[model samples]
Target: MRERNVVSAQTQLLSTVAPSQSPSFDPDLGVITPPSNGMARSAFARPVAPRARWRRRYLACLVLIDFVTALGASRTVVALLDEADAGFWDQRVLGGAVSAFALVTNLVVPLMWMTVLVAAGAYDRRALGRGTEELKRVARANVAMAATVSFLALGFKKDLSRATVAAIILTLLLYTLVTRALARVVLRRIRRVSQRASQKVLLVGRLSDAMAVHEVVTRNPGAGLRPIAIHLPHHPRPGERVTAPVPVYVGWDLVPLVQQLGADTIAVCGPASLESYELRKLAWQLEGTGLDLVVVPQVTDVTGPRIHVRPIEGLPLLNVEEPTISGLSLLVKSMLDRVTALVGLVLLSPLLVGIAVAIKLTDPGPVMFRQTRIGHEGRAFKVWKFRTMYTDAEQRLEALRHRNESDGLLFKIKDDPRVTPIGRHLRGLSLDELPQLINVLKGEMSLVGPRPLPTEDDDYRGDVRRRLLVRPGITGLWQISGRSDLTWEDAVRLDLHYVDNWSLVYDLGILWRTASVVLARRGAY
Candidate 1:
């Protein structure tokens, strides 16, 4: 009788709410407020989702940053040119056009740049604060701005200086990228701390699928998804226990449940019980609720660049492109690797010589250590590094094998007795691996790829052998991620991921991150 009354009251409350009108909740008063125009009260109105709020805030921040960056860049360029040329601003180009040009540079340019960025979708919520898409858009927008300026200058016969145009564009691009990156760092830190700053996700699916999604969102807090609850399609059997980190619910009536739990995002993962028609109906139910529905596809590991969505009739088809292991891009990567390796070696020769001298003076062993390691396509090559271990290190390997702190084929010891005092410092700073730049120059290795393993650890087979498809590297995803601290499985996974997603841009990002990791000495022995 009590349950029926409760249901009746809920039904009456919902019936009173108009289809188009959403009720507003007062958290302090714990009641739903009617529309300001004196409309009927609603029980279904929810506050704006935290995810949406944060996204709006972030987007506004980006717009402000872009505008400020563009303005600053323009002003800086104008100031520098004026100072350098002495009469740069005063000079008449095309009959006393100095004032007009000044107006364009000071006011018109920043607005035009912002317009280009908006049209390029740099400030789109989906692109903002995630991935390289935002950065790429900003770069393209700058290019477009440059082209537009050149076209206007040519068409109107305006005496626009190419140097000034290039300077403004370059400055804007650099400033925007740096400011956006710093903004992302700050936003990520905030999201990591404040649960309300992230999307409150309600997971709906089979237990296993839900758990998988849960693990992913939990692992990446920067994704800004906080799982609030799990909703199963069916109830557990008698005496059966269902264990979950979040609160669990069972039923088809998800609207009320979602509102009650304050979940703004519904993630449907591997919907076994929810068929096509039912899923469509769920979408209909959520139409005016201001809630976001995210469907998790089974496909994994592939990134956005590789995946293309094609819609035929109403069915969406996913087309996955083959990894770019070879071709023009790989050729470019190879060229870059060799060129960078050459430059690095030339610049660091003094430091390298100093390390070599120090090792010889203290360790009483050969300065350079070479080991037979597997390289690209199972080719055996002698990997070079500054010797970090004593001359008798090989002999003591068997005795220390039992004390190996690493998992899988790799052998590592945090406090190995074989490492000389100077060697330990060199290893900690990753200076010992500097000589591999020689291998990179020789085409035997890459500046960024899988770490080359010694002959004894060569157990490549199946998908694992894919790591050998590319030249090994001095530093890679594995090195920057955790190095010796990562488990063998994790190391192999990272290596394979790098191999599968190899790109010049990805390599550059890893190289950039590697500097910070090395400086921190994280996971290094």
Candidate 2:
């Protein structure tokens, strides 16, 4: 399919060529070309020197710091070993003096660790300023290096001290990760304050597609993709600027535009609907230019691990792995949820008792509120929470239905009349939901999953119901992003995204973000 499209584009380009010679036209391909070297030099408005230099300098400094950190960790390990009792674990490893072993481990091992990091592509420019991926690679590289070294020592029958080797490897891994994290923080700060550190991006797509990408990049400054302008292939009005979230340009004379904006990257979205051949030709034209080309697929909210590309013949096929429904991973998730919930209930028993007493005193009603809610696999369960409303709150719900401010099947208001004063405080702090830990212990809920809906709400069907495949949670993406504040569509989108991409690491990250959001009390009511 891609090859045919490319061939079709080539055929179409032949018909558009001018009869006479033109500077921007390629005679062999019969296609319009980018600006010639002399024209680009004359028309180029922005210079790329400063930004390129800043990027290179930052990468170099980061690599140097990481290597230095490895050395420091190695030295500390050696110092600790030197101080240990002589008879206590053989100071005579390698059949030599402690100083001799120290020299080799401190110098040689640190160098090997640094080499491993470089070989792992930790210093690649594409990875710079990116989050988590780089750190993950750093840790992986250290682990691989440790395993290789340990294996070699055992195979060669070398008299290496296991205690010293283990200590040094552990220290090196810890030191490298801490230093890289700190470095990322400083570099991200610099990227925000220094224009030269940010990568200028030129988006090519429809207004809506470009705007979507623009919003994501703007929201995540750490991504470092600063949108300077957008190019609309099918501009409604030629030679007229369209005011989008950013400046939108028309027509396909992209080389001069790229030069003018000094863009470091050109991000093309699929919605532009360019022929495969045209995109290939554009990439060819950009070969000599320093701009990096990034293709943004139309598929949204998919994680990197699930999306795979397989090139067959001349076409690239995207294969999206189905989300895991039942596996060892699910078992791990269940175990963690139950263990954490049990421990939390025990630890917070005193606080829970106090909350129960307060609720009973204030409302003179049930301390616990029980309501039927949907759970995994569409199972109905009685969800538990500390009662936050009056005894007759359910009866008055129909009268207050017209006051619903929350969108979708969920009904909520900023200041619901049913909520008692104590209830309002508890809701604000999310303390009212603490009793749901019992649900997690009972295996009716998870620590992190989609929000369970009330049994009365039957608005979900089709893909939306897939959220039921996993155990519902007390808090999830919906809670961390915005609870009642998010629109119905956005809330479902986030929940579905989590359903498809949930992993142990991903869950941990969400949990960390959840902590901060809970404290800030943003969008809680």
Candidate 3:
């Protein structure tokens, strides 16, 4: 009897809350929408909303940039070749002046380049302004353009200058990449300042799942998803309070709620209450709404390169590839690390000498500090760095243990009296760690990887041991993210993430960002 009363109350609530021509609802199938009142129009029939205008404008800007880059590159290369060889375009071919052929070729090249890029999905809105996928697509499109040009030249029996063609392709690739990267920088700046630039997302799932999704969104502000509200399947019991930053709503009929909130996206995070049929019904209701639906998967800490989507019949399956910890990539990384370390040590020799002299003058201690650290596969190696602390700093450590700032096994203090006056400046600018290049050169460390801990702090068990799979590094995700300022848990999480998703591209990105982080002195001593 109570169940029937509850059902009656829910029906009455829906009737009172929804519009007069609201979609039909089923007790089992959830909110089912009929084709009446334009609720079920084709996706193409929907008009573009004001919120989506920015995407179209951005796309147009990219197209213009790419077209200009291609034309400019071809023109510049051709002009340079013409200057070097006066008769470059003088030879007549196919009953027309070669100059005319060259003119036509210049115009046709950019068009062909644009067409190939469009076919390769280089300008996909979802990939723009984030991730390495956009750059990869652009690279693939450039390769395709080169191949097409070569095939056409050979098939037509035309003696095209290979140098000019190669130069044009290479120049276009470099220019387009630079322009796109700059565009992303500008877009990120704008989105950071104006919340209106981001997509208003309505989270729909259990409270825990919604909170997890919120945390992920918070961590990645560049994703541009601003959580407006959370919609749960049922009402909270008395004394139960939601701690999420967004407002909370109850009930399964989320279309009207989403519309009312003016949310442009709905993020369904492992909806426990919605069955397959109900989920489909919800999608049906949003067919002509011009809204984006993002279903967040349960997977965590995995990147796009490792995940593959395979569909069988009508079911979509996600296949995650194993992490690459060995093979040719590691060999390349090792060679690069040693080569870079050698060059850095040679170039910075003068600065290193000056620092050594200053350290000798400031305090009475050794110029270099070497401490045993846990390395790959539980091996121990003496890591090298410029001495920044007093000679008796270790002896005085126990007295300061009670005042340690870190919550985990690592110990850190924002302003330690043990540091010498000159040491403070070196630590702040990250110059104190320059000596570690020797370790990198010696194969005891890498240019980029998880930071190795001292021997006493080594707890190589469970997932923590994964950090030992590769050589320790002087700088890593932890360094670029937040050095000593990060909590132990956050630091470990970042280290593990780098270990599981390490790539040459990823290493380069971290190295690039490290310079900015060091300049800003973020989370430094």
Q: What C-alpha lDDT do the candidate models reach, one value each?
A: 0.81, 0.78, 0.80
Q: Candidate 2's C-alpha lDDT?
A: 0.78
Once all C-alphas are superposed, what RMSD does model 3 give against the true structure?
Answer: 6.6
- Candidate order by lDDT, decreasing, is 1, 3, 2
Candidate 2 lDDT, tens digit per residue, 132-244?
78888888898888888888888998877788778888888888888887887787777667744778898888777887888877865666778876777773643433345
Candidate 3 accuracy as lDDT: 0.80
Query: Worst lDDT window (10 residues) for model 3?
Result: 26-35
RMSD of 1: 7.6
Query: Which model is ahead, 1 or 2, in terms of TM-score?
Result: 1
Error of 3 at 397 (Å): 2.4
What are the models' TM-scores? 0.84, 0.81, 0.86
Cα deviation of 334, candidate 1, in Å: 1.5
Residue 154 local lDDT, model 3? 93
Whole-model lDDT, candidate 1? 0.81
**lDDT tens digits by residue: candidate 3, 1-525:** 544443454455345444655544344422223224534424344433236667788889989988888888888877887789887655445457776767655678778889999988898866787757888889999999899989999999988878877998898899888888888877777787775457888898888899888987877676678887777766565656444455555653566566656678888887485677767776776777777888887877888589898999977788889999999999999999999999999999999999999999989979999999998778888989899999999999999998899876687889998999899899999999999999999999999999989855356777888888888998999999889989888888899999889999999999998999999999988
